[model samples]
Target chain A: DTAVSQTPKYLVTQMGNDKSIKCEQNLGHDTMYWYKQDSKKFLKIMFSYNNKELIINETVPNRFSPKSPDKAHLNLHINSLELGDSAVYFCASSQDRQSEQFFGPGTRLTVL
Target chain B: AQSVAQPEDQVNVAEGNPLTVKCTYSVSGNPYLFWYVQYPNRGLQFLLKYITGDNLVKGSYGFEAEFNKSQTSFHLKKPSALVSDSALYFCAVRARYNDYKLSFGAGTTVTVRA
Candidate 1:
């Protein structure tokens, strides 16, 4: 079974368009995170949610918003997507704040 | 603030040879170190972690890491590397007091040739 899964493996949209990526985890984890990997392969955490509660909000732009409808799911919505948004976004989940994370197959987002 | 650094951008090794990827970290308090590997078009996979206990931690796929508090380093090693082991490796560090944020290094690409 896939512990962590992400939908829309590839997203190609025009500039200024809006897009959303869905993520779900069956690991029964309490914490979920969204990370962005740039072209240079630098990974950075953008947002983190614990038990559906926002815990860590990094210095990300307001255009990007993360929503957790339930503890098992976390989704990312980007408004006014720009060329800079072209990168792979990863969704990860952990049992708790101090546990090892399981990551899902990343969604490759391309903003043309 | 906690951070990790992977000085080597790439490491090439022959199949059945030993492999090593260097990593160093900086954090205020005790660090929770982790190693993750990523294949092309795939997400990062957890290899091992060091929370507290033995300095030498063994992980999945014949991989292990040594945690050195004095040097603030957690380097990943594999005794016999396979061609399939060629991928990108990341070293992450999280402070004990910090909530749930992991600071990842720039990443090192390992190329294991048969």
Candidate 2:
């Protein structure tokens, strides 16, 4: 069974376009996170939500927003996409604050 | 802030040989360390973690890691590696008091030749 899943395994768009990536976790996790992996394979956390509430927001641009309608779902929306946003976006979830996170098949976003 | 470092960018090994991936971390308070492996075009799979206990932690696929508190390092090791073990490996750290934020290292690419 897929514990975490994300839609649109690949995404390509022009700069200034708006896009959204959907994520869902069936692991009954209480915390969810958004991470970006650059071409160099450097991973960084962008946002995190706990029980559908915002918790961690890193040094991301204001154009990015995360919405959690429920505990099991966390969606990332990027407005006015930039070329620098081209990277693999991964969604992860954990049972609590101090547990190993399960990752979803990442969405490779390409902003042309 | 909690952070992890994977000094090596790539590791090459032959089948049936031993494999090791080095990792070091820094945290303000106690740290929670983890190892994850990712195949091409796939998500990261949890291999193991060091929260507390016996310093040496064994994980999936005959993999193991030794947590050194004094050195602040957690290295992944496999006694006998197969070509199928080739993948991207990542080390992550999270401070005990910090929220759900996990700091990941620049992944190390492992290539096991058969």
Candidate 3:
């Protein structure tokens, strides 16, 4: 069974299109995170939510917003996507702040 | 600011030989160090972590990491390298007293030759 899963594994859209990527974890974790891996393979934290509460918000652009409906799901919505938004988005979850994080199969976003 | 650095961009080793991937970090308080591996077209997978206690922590697939506090390094090592073990490895860190976000290194690609 997949401990973490992201929907729309592959998303391809034109510039200025709005898109959303969904993430869910089944490991009963309280903290979830969103990460972006650029073309150079540098993984950076975009946002983190603990018990549906915003905990960490990096200097990501306001065009990107994260929403956590519950402790099990954290979804990312992109507004007016641009070519620079093309990269792989990863979803992760952990029991607490100091626990090892479990990552889901990333969603490859391609803004053409 | 908390950050992790992987000095080497790539490491090549022959099968059956020992291998090491270097990682260093800078944090204000006690650091939570972790190692993760990623294959092509896949997300990162947790390998091991050093929270406290022993300096050497063993992890999956016969992987182990040595935590050197003075040196501020947590290097991943394997006694014998396998071809299938080759992949992109990342070292991550998060201050124990800080937020839940983990800062990752630039990643090192390990290529084990048959």
Q: lDDT for every model?
A: 0.96, 0.95, 0.96
Extract clashing residue pairs from model 3.
Answer: none
lDDT value, candidate 3, whole model: 0.96
lDDT of 1 by residue, A1-112 (tens): 8999998999999999999999999989999999999999899999999999999999999999999999999999999999999999999999986789999999999988
Write the residue-wise lDDT of candidate 3 on B1-114 in tens digits.
899999999999999999999999999988999999999999889999999999999999999999999999999999999999999999999988786878899999999999
Model 1 chain A weakest lDDT span, ten residues long: A96-105
* Model 1 misplaced stretches (Cα beyond 4 Å): none
Model 1 chain B poorest ten-residue lDDT run: B93-102
Writing each residue's lDDT as its tens digit, candidate 2 over A1-112 gives 7899998899999999999999999999999999999998888999999988889999999999999999999999999999999999999999987689999999999999
Model 1 residue pairs with clashes? none
Report candidate 3's fraction of native contacts.
Answer: 0.88
Better of 1 and 2 by lDDT: 1
Model 3, position B101, has a per-residue lDDT of 72
Q: Recovered native contacts in candidate 2, as a fraction?
A: 0.95
Each candidate's TM vs. the true structure? 0.98, 0.98, 0.99
Per-residue CA lDDT of candidate 3, range A12-66, in tens? 9999999999999999999999999999999999999999999899999999999
lDDT value, residue B62 of candidate 2: 94
